[model samples]
Target: MRKLILLVAMLAMVLVGSVPALAQSTLSGDQGANPPESDGGSVRGIITDISGSVVLVEADPSASSGPKGYFTVTDETEIARLEGDIRIRASFEDLEVGQQVQADYAGPIAESYPPQGEAGSIVILDEGGETDREATLSFELEVECDPPANAAFFGFIPAEGGINAQLTDPDEDGVYTGSVNVPKFPPGPAPPGTEPVSLPVQIVQVRGVIKDFGEVKIDGDKTFKATVSFCDDNGGGSGNGGSSSGGGKTLPNTGGVLPITLGAGALLVAGGLLARRLGR
Candidate 1:
């Protein structure tokens, strides 16, 4: 009985002692299991907030709606702030709220709401940065008709009363062309406690219609067609529909850790049983 108690005690000590080494090995393997960054995409928006290595970006609204969430920003991320014709290198500490910026990152971007991907590089847009034009962006379209149309019209959405403009086919060709200037920033006072208006990156739906008959306008007779595009030149940049990165956080492997813990517990239970039997 004494020998039995000694054997159980020795077994428990051996198993318990091995637990630390097994756990350490398991943790080291987990550290290496993190996925590496690959060729990703980009996102441009204003920084609404920051926590740890993550920053919440108010990306341009799109047809596919989702909630705004946090994006991981890390030391490896290349950050820069534009200064009048020069791109000044920046760090994570320099990022601020309300500044319009663009982040280019590695992929494959996670398909979660308010999608996420790590930024390989970030550029802060100055007032007149290369891609930060505040001027009107123009749109053009052409239409086909039998007889030369007496009048043509074009329009886009999200505009006050909807934007409307007359189109012209100057060359007498059935193809008609027209353009509307949309400012990168909406003109008006921003709502109280809100950031300045940044143009939404959307599939701008443009419509064009031509009327051949003068006085009487017939719906069937008038040639109508629609065009759509994701305007990247405006608030949109070369990106994965405005996404951020949370790729750094990966779940650790518990396979090895679990066994180590279980073995230790089993050994302790056997030792207790042996000691209780000896006491009896």
Candidate 2:
């Protein structure tokens, strides 16, 4: 009968070509439908100024339904791995100043910028790009006395010194940042009194070691200030500590009595000049 009408018009063109791949696998449930002409290149903003590696985002031009441009994030460690706590998500969580953001970006497409300045634009979830390969150590700190406003400034982890993390300044305006992960700093000079002498690192798992430092607290005052940096695998930098403009210095909680009181006053002035040269 004409082969049953040619198998019913070849099963109605294979069910209309499987209805757009089963409606794109049921709206990407299993992942398979991101192409309505797919742009995948976006950037919606409102982050006005961030200094030190520069970040001045302010383009919400109506949160783009599509098409509209003007971007700049120039990689400050990818904008601190996409704003982890940048003064509390870009200024006290309200995230205002024209609140709005959307970013996807691919990479490399400069017209006139790109010296060390180029994240191009990727503000989607506000910031995303840190698979946790583990290795982060950022820096900046300043506070020469005056820390008791609420008390909460502790950071020190140069591979066993301990206490690695706890800092705040979400625009309270005192200057203190964050980052941590330790277990590597064996190049030299870090075991003597240990107050940040020098540490610049970027090495993963050879024994860890990711440090980003800061310290400060002021409202009533009790003394506080610190700034440090280190990242293992050999490739990171920053260092500084108490006294020398960092203020705050009083240490000496016993033991070794201030170098044994300067070695017993230099052995009583060298035994009274050797008993006056054996009594002349």
Question: What is the C-alpha local distance difference test score of each model?
Answer: 0.50, 0.40
Candidate 2 is scored at a TM of 0.18
Against the true structure, what is each candidate's TM-score?
Answer: 0.29, 0.18
Q: Residue 181 CA error for candidate 2 (Å)?
A: 7.7
For model 1, the stretches where C-alpha displacement exceeds 4 angstroms are 1-40, 61-70, 128-280
Writing each residue's lDDT as its tens digit, candidate 1 over 1-280 gives: 9999999999999999999999999999997765432223555677777777777665654423333434677667777766444455667888888778776755456765565767667677886545331333233444322321222334333344554445555886544455554443235432222222333211221212211112211111123333322243232221123212223322223233677889999999999999999999
C-alpha RMSD in Å of predicted model 1 compared with the true structure: 42.5
Error of 2 at 150 (Å): 25
On the 0 to 100 scale, the lDDT of residue 163 in model 2 is: 32
Best by TM-score: 1
List, residue by residue over 108-217, the lDDT tens digit for candidate 2: 43432111224443332334432222234443455334443333444444343443455556876666655565422233433321222233222111112223333321
